[model samples]
Target: MSLHTASCRCGAIRFEARAEPFYASYCHCEDCRRASGSPVAAFVGFYTRDARFIGEAPGTYGAAPVTRSFCRTCGAPLSYVDARLPDQIFMMLGAMDAPEKYPPTVHGYVSEALPFFHIADGLPQMETSTVPRPKEDGQ
Candidate 1:
């Protein structure tokens, strides 16, 4: 099982989660853009059963259907949990020690992507928030 540990900038909050991720993507949704104050937000998903919080629990805010958690000391957005996906936790890639280890395989919410921002990475791009399915056996 793969394991990942991530922390806020000030190290006031940390997270440890094991097992493979359910999904990983770069989200261009407006909500995520506003939350991260960036053109896009990269995130990783893992089953809540294999995750644990260390140090102090971060402060949180209601971001519509989910609660966005962040470090009060450094104000870095760490994780966001959506009730719609109750079994998983979505964490910001930047908070991880080696964000490069989790390369995003898809891009979501392209409809909301800023016109000036273009991603030429060739990954699958979805117009909205659609969970991608794994490739099956040969046709």
Candidate 2:
């Protein structure tokens, strides 16, 4: 896949993903909702080697051992990096220059989804904190 570029609202932070995302998901966890100030947060997952950051690396903080990066100037949440998944990164979908290019494949943390929010019926849904297990692994 060809590389795709993305940036924060103010354009102070930019990034590029070298390939199409492996998957896309919407997170309804409280931290996501609070950090994004949205009912849910959309993310596009890719391998770390497949993505690059232009300009300065954004400010980062550990939300656990996992780190969340954001544009300090604009406070736009940009990406999530985890030691457990050292090779992969999850970029905030809203930061994409063409967010339409990546559509969410699933809804996660459904138990924390807002009571008044309405999720469309067709997409797959999972209630657990982690992603669903692959069929063969039964994670």
List TM-score per model, in order: 0.90, 0.89
Q: How well is each residue in 9-32 modelled by candidate 2, as lDDT tens digits?
A: 788888998887887899898888
CA lDDT, every prediction?
0.88, 0.84
Alpha carbon deviation, residue 62, candidate 1 (Å)? 1.7
RMSD of each: 5.5, 3.3
Worst 10 residues of 2 by lDDT: 130-139
lDDT: which candidate is best?
1
- Residue 106 of model 1, lDDT score: 94
lDDT against true structure, model 2: 0.84
Model 1, C-alpha of 19: deviation from truth (Å): 1.2
**Tens digits of per-residue lDDT for model 1, 2-41:** 7899999989899999887777899999999999999999
Candidate 1 residue-wise lDDT at 122: 99
Off by over 4 Å in 1: 132-139
Superposed Cα deviation of residue 28, candidate 2 (Å): 0.8
